[model samples]
Target: MTNAVFHWPVSSLVQITDCHLLATPDALYQGIKPYHHLRLVLDELRAEAPLLILTGDLTEDHSADSYTLLQQLLADWPAPVFLLPGNHDERGALDQLSQQPPFRPERRLALPGWQLWLLDSKGDTPAGSFPVPRLAELECWLNEAGHQQIFWFCHHHLLPVGSFIDRFDQQDKAGLLAMLKREPRLRGLAHGHCHHAYQYDLPEFVQVGCPASSVQFLQTPDWQTQDQGPRACRWVFTPDGRLQWEFLQF
Candidate 1:
C-alpha cells in the first residue's frame, strides 16, 4: 500500500463508482452504453482533482478487456487512481491494472490529518463481507493511526438506504461497525454498490453512498430503473479533519 502523506492545507478527491463497463466499447448494460456514459462522466471532470477513487463494480462482464479499457480510458488522468473490488469484479482481472502507473491497488492512503481505508467487502455472494482476517488488519491500522481521523471506502453499504438493495448490505456490518465505533477517529464512510446517492448520519460518523458512473438505481423496494444518467461524487478534506462532499450529475 502507498503511504505518502500530503502536506496541503486542503485536499480533494473525486469518486467514480460502479462503472459496470463491458468487454467491448460498443456493448451496453441495462439498455445504456456504459463506456459512453463513463466517457461523459470523465469529460465532465475536466478540472484537475488531486486523487480519484473508483469504489467498485468497475466491470459488468468481469473481463480483462474491460480492465484494460478502463486503464486506457484513464491513462491521461492528472491524479492517482485508487481501486477496490466489488462483488462483480474478478481479482485476477483487476490486478492487471496495478502493474501500470496512475492505477494503484493500494487499500490504505494517508492524508495530512486523515487516513483513508479502502476496505474489501467483496464476498462469495452479492452481499458484502468483512472477513475476520481483514477485520484484524483494520483493527491494527486503527490502533496505529493514533489520533488521525479515518474515512472508510468500500463497495457495499453498511446501512440500509431505504431500497431493495438493502437486503444485500454487508453481512458482517455489525462487527465492522463495532470496530469502527471503538475508534473515535472514524469520521466518515463512503461506498458504491446500490448505484444511487444517499447519506446517513451515524452516532460516530456519516456514511455517504456514491452514485454509479454508468447508471443510477431507483430507490424503490424492488430492482427497478428510473434514471440511467451518469453521476460522480466529489470530496474535499480540510486539514482540521472536516469533510465536505457533493454529487455531480449529468
Candidate 2:
C-alpha cells in the first residue's frame, strides 16, 4: 500500500473472511461446508455498501475455478470488492482473478474520516510476517498519508490473542509494535483467520479479530474438535470518525 488514489467514504464496509469455499458444491471441509454459509451471509448483507473486502482464505480447496463461482455470486453487487490473499491461497490465481471487474484488489483506501492500508501477510506457513518489502511499503504509506487517521487490515493477527492459536500470530510482531509506535497516525486495525472474535487495545490504537465465515476454531490452540458458526465483520465509520466493529453471525 504505497499510495492512495481514492478519496473519502462511500458507505459502510463489510469484511468477509476465511470463507474456505470448495470447488464442488458437496465438498466438506473439516466436515463443514462454508459456501453454504457464505450464501447465508450474503443474504444478510442486502444493505448498501461502499466497499466489500474478502480478507482471504477464500477457498479451502484453493481451486482457481472457485473464484469464477465467486464472481458469479457477486455479479449483481453494486459496490466494488477487493481481495487480500491469505496463507491458503495461490497468489497467482487470485491476482489474475482480481484484475477483472468488481474485484479491484486495491490496497489503499482513504475514507472520509479514515485511511485504510490493507496488507497481505501470507508467508511460508499459517503464521504471517511483515517481510522487508511489506514493512517498507507500509513505511511509505505512512510517510505520505500518515497525517490522516489510519486503519490497518490484514489476514492474520498482529499479536497473540492468549489462546493456543497464539502460535499462529505474526512472527514479526515485535517489529510491528515498534513500527506502530513510530507511526502515530494509525488509529486501529482489523484482521481475520483466528476464527474467533476479539477486541483489544494497543498503546495507540485498537485491534479487532474477525470471526470466520465457516467453523469457529477452538480458541485454545490445543487439539479440540471445533466450534460451529459463521459470521461477517462489519466496520462502521461515522461522521465523527468513530471506527466501530461488530460481528454479524449467520
> What are the lDDT figures for the candidates, one per model?
0.84, 0.77
Candidate 1 residues 171-236, lDDT tens each? 988888887677788887999999988898888889899999887889898898655588999998
**Model 2 lDDT tens row, 109-193:** 8777667878888888888877887787777777787457788888988877877767877888776777777767777678887
Q: Which predicted model would earn the best TM-score? A: 1
Candidate 2 regions exceeding 4 Å error are 1-4, 223-228
Query: Which RMSD does model 1 reach against the true structure?
Result: 1.9
Q: Which stretches of candidate 1 lie over 4 Å from their true place?
A: 1-10
Model 1 alpha-carbon miss at residue 79, Å: 0.9
